[model samples]
Target: MSFFIRGRRRDVKEKKGKKRGLKNKQVLPVKKSKFDSGLDEEITSDEEEEYLKGKVNDIAEKEAEDVETAQEKKVRLAREYIQELRKERENEDDEELDDKAVAARLQEEVLESAGKLRRLVAETFLEPVSEDFIVLKSKHQKLPITCLTVTNDGKFIFSGSKDCSIVKYSIEGKRLGHIPGGRKGTENLHTGHTSHIYSLAVSSDGRFLASGDKGGIIHIWDGETLKHLKKFKSHRDAVSALAFRHSSHTLYSASYDRMVMVWDLDTMAFVEHLGGHQDAITGIDSLARESCITSGGRDQSVIVYVIAEDKQLRFVSPHESVDGVKLVDERTFVTFGQEGSLGIWTTLKKRPHHMIKRAHGCQAENGLPNWICSATTLVNTDLVASGSMDGHVRLWKITVDRGHRKLEPLFSIPIPGVVNALAFTSNGSHLIIGIGQEHKLGRWFKDKKAKNSIVVVSMKKNV
Candidate 1:
């Protein structure tokens, strides 16, 4: 009887030992083989402690994963989103580069094949009947349009008006946007001009659009969205002109305060101010060079501001006022004045290289020469146009004969209103005109018969 009782006790002891080994193996996976060796094997105190620690660690890890905080989850998602945006931007940049390469190749082919072709002249193609013109008028701009500017791609046009508003139009004469002007005391509104907007300019890259007002305020806007970005208030008088350096964000502005100021659009800060004009600057133009050309109103001077050297090259104009100026090339420019004379000038000379007196002809009623209010040139071409109240917008062809440049009348388009501003598309395919009943500077004269509108003349290439 005693032997049988001892055998049962031994069997119970072996069963408990096997259960202990299985628990250790489950907790400490690395010790599974040792625990499976035999139920008779006894685990050390250190081994038992390690098994407990491993069990705790596993439980903590699972809890941490399940209890992830909302903030941590958000951070993970944000990291993934930013990575996606970076990838998209990289893809877009690659596409832009490929497109540019193809465009360059096409342009090179056109130039090479056309080498033997006759020199293209604007006169042969610019003749448009009255019906060929597209007139854009807006109810938001009830007053006369003061200035107009076209984008480098010839896709959009921006027009400023005496009503203190600005209207944007597509090349197809569709109104895209309108910035309504505020009252005089609403300068803090920062929506649109509170005074007459005299000039408008867009950067060559189509990233920035700048507008100047008669109240000496300059507003910078996003080129694509037309949203106001910044405002500059350094000039003390009416801001007469605004221009952007080609392929850059550098802006040059002229004012009636007899000062020209430079602004960097990238930094949204003023760079420096130039002082050379004795009177109000009426017109300003710039090209690829780091310089600008301006006409001095009543100063009878056409000054070229060399920004790099901080020097001014002043050319004396035969006309009295020198109301407007436009650069023909890097060194040559054209100017017109209130005295009804047009002058072609070069930076190398102090006087005009060529002068056309009474170019617009005298008025019939008063027998006085009609004042040439505005002028523009087809960049890098021999084509120029001038505007006045002379009942026509005259186009002139610049003829180069043995190193001498002369202006020859090509044709005229009968525009009834006082032509305040003119701009040519970058490719010289279209001519934009700003016409109004009253003069841009002031109410010096009124054309009751004229209408306030923006006219776009489409010129087909003469093949």
Candidate 2:
């Protein structure tokens, strides 16, 4: 179906602003009396031609100027980016040690410093937009959304529900599909979980998807295909949380049985069980280093376990029930609890460096502080996000410079129901939240109007 049409190029310059009139070249009417007297009217043809030529010249000049300006802007941006990189490299070199005693120490320190600079630059490039955060999209899952996780590339969001199914959604909030749940029946019919799916995790490499259910079962799926790969029994009780070690196949699972178990993903084998929490382990997260952290429910404790040493360290209790735990950095982490307590702890210390007994204001009808059920940290930034049963999602910034750390309030947004899960997109552009009614005893109807839904929040550009 190839076809070619001969066309002439048209360089048309549209007029902008006020229209100019060629007053001198106005079309004159010749009088009949003058024609009868054999008189001829003088014409300004030369002037008219000169005026038209000048107009074209002006338009051409303006277009050329615009093109040059755009080129200059591009070059300026390129130069600034190059300069930033050079500055980072120079800073890396400026920290060189004078001592030749430890060559290994020098090389390691240099690489660490350079890596830090690179991360800082990368974060700066994706700084949240300055505009007001918006509700970009909302998805009704028709079941209580218990957990949600955004993929590493920010293309998809996987949500687990009380119905025991894992539904996948695109970034635009379109339902793509769902993974088949539950055990294979003898009838060869596909079914989902028989219990609530409470925890969801995606590997850092974006290759694997894992979900934990109320029956203490963990299901593994191919991240790209969303196909069920394997299912295994992990704990005696329900699995409360799951986290994958960054850049590794190792996975850490926290269960209501008060056990933290590490799994070898490649072989689907249990590596070891970490026992420290006296009650249910409600929240868990892995650090960039070879370690993981967990928070207990009824026992109200936060435990840090070092994988290399195969031991626990720095056990502390900050509240009655630490419901949410998030790793802010390799050394620092944050925890929130049922009493609305928010605490910042460092691996170097046994006690929390900063604490807020009641971080959120809303209280239940019984005067109990709203429990914070979930938390997540913005990568490469000091910001932490927490969602509570008070129907509010709050953001906080932590400062840890020179041991004088403080938790500063940034902002809070109200949700229609309890926020069960919270995660930031890999690029920090959107916040994916699982929101629904907080199931309560003898309060079945309160959740009737609370449609199970997933909310995607756009962040303030400058945030």
Candidate 3:
């Protein structure tokens, strides 16, 4: 019985070994499989392929993650760079202060205080602006004063007369020099106009003076020496106005010849001619940009033309004959007409933004509104002054209501004669007025001698 049990155990062992050998042959290639030691060193073909595929996926995922991280780093760095540039630009814009900037800042502060005081006074008592003016000086003219301009520094005042001459005077009314009439033979005097001097303009630096005459002659002079610089034939008819660009040597002249001429002071040559008006161009003024010009004429229209483009950007008739036009600011301008109508215009619109019908306080015997001869704006203020043939000067305060500007009558000054021209000092401290007789076809008036006067009014100085 022992021998038979031993023989059966041996057979069981041999069958177990054969089964193990079969499994190893499936797993091993040429060597014994490490799976016998439970190390998993050997694998089937299907298992090996699965392991390689997983390894490839892992490496691909890592590479993709690295690329994404690099892109994110670039984005972060670009954002930082843009932020730094914006900060630098902001700092530069904030630090651009100069002497002019300082002066402007102080002026703005003073104006703010004054405006507050004015509002307070108006609200407290509902009182009118006092004749808040005092006559500083008055000088008589030999001829009817047609136009006048004050120097920016308030040191000199130039008066043009129908008598064909220009007179220079100190701010104190002291006579400085007389620019002779006629451009023919006077070497000692400026090549004055042979006809009536109707318009005058001074350079921004107060170094040059320009005079235009009824004969279409333009005379340039040294403001300091009163010497003739040059004489040019500008138009076929009377030259109505002259304006010098601020801080530049460029000049513009409007003529009854229906043309506006541009000149270069540095070259003393004509640059170009701007023409669009159908009738005589009466008034012309330049914008602060010096690239555009605003002109009005008897054609009953106002035209704004761009110099570089040589194109008329705007043309409109405000239902009246505009005799005078003046730019008050970059966006705003004032126009006065033959019917005493004053209108405010803007660059964005072709029509008048505001209109003051019957701006002059008086009417004519023909039952029509009196003529508005000239108009000007006070420096650094929203005050507009208009002169009329009725011998009255009216002041208007510009205000905004419902996003539209309106001119409210502030005060009126009754002078002895018809007001021909109006101007203000650069600082708005004084108002320079030119008065003359309103002659009808050579008929003299009662106050003919009383006319042709230059009046200097102290504004803020007296106030």
Q: Could you report the Cα RMSD, in angstroms, for every candidate shown?
A: 17.0, 24.1, 23.0
lDDT of 3: 0.72
Q: How far does residue 310 in candidate 2 sit from its true spot (Å)?
A: 1.8
Task: Give the best candidate by lDDT.
Answer: 1
**What does candidate 2's lDDT look like per residue over 1-463, in tens digits?**
2232222212121132114544455567855774456334454889778867998999999997777776788788766754555454534454443223234444544454232311332223233343433332233245567888888889888998776678888887677877645442321355346677888899888788888888888888888888777777859988889999886778899999999888887998889988988888888998457788888877867888877887777557656677778876676778887677888787778888898777776565667666666778876567778887666788887775787567877767767677778898867778888877754111232445455687777664533
Minimum summed lDDT over a 10-residue window in model 1 is located at: 111-120
Q: How many collisions between residues are there in candidate 2?
A: 7
Looking at model 1, the pairs that clash are: none
Error of 2 at 190 (Å): 4.9
lDDT of 3 by residue, 245-294 (tens): 77678998999888889999988999998888888888877634555455
The alpha-carbon root-mean-square deviation between model 1 and the true structure, to one decimal in Å, is: 17.0
Writing each residue's lDDT as its tens digit, candidate 1 over 1-463 gives: 6999999999998798887776543443455566566644688999889977998999999999899798999788766754554454544667666556555554653453332112347667757887779999999888999999999999999999998998999988999998888889989855878999999999998899999998999999987888989888899999999999987899999999999999999999999999988898888999877899898989888888888888888888766788888988777789888778898776767877789989999989888999888889887778899999988999998887775778989889899989999998988889999999999878978999988999999876667
For all predicted structures, in order, the TM-scores are 0.75, 0.69, 0.69
Better of 1 and 2 by TM-score: 1
| Deviation from native of the Cα of residue 186 in model 3, angstroms | 9.7
lDDT, ranked from best to worst: 1, 3, 2
- List runs of model 3 lying over 4 Å from the truth: 1-140, 182-190, 439-449, 461-463
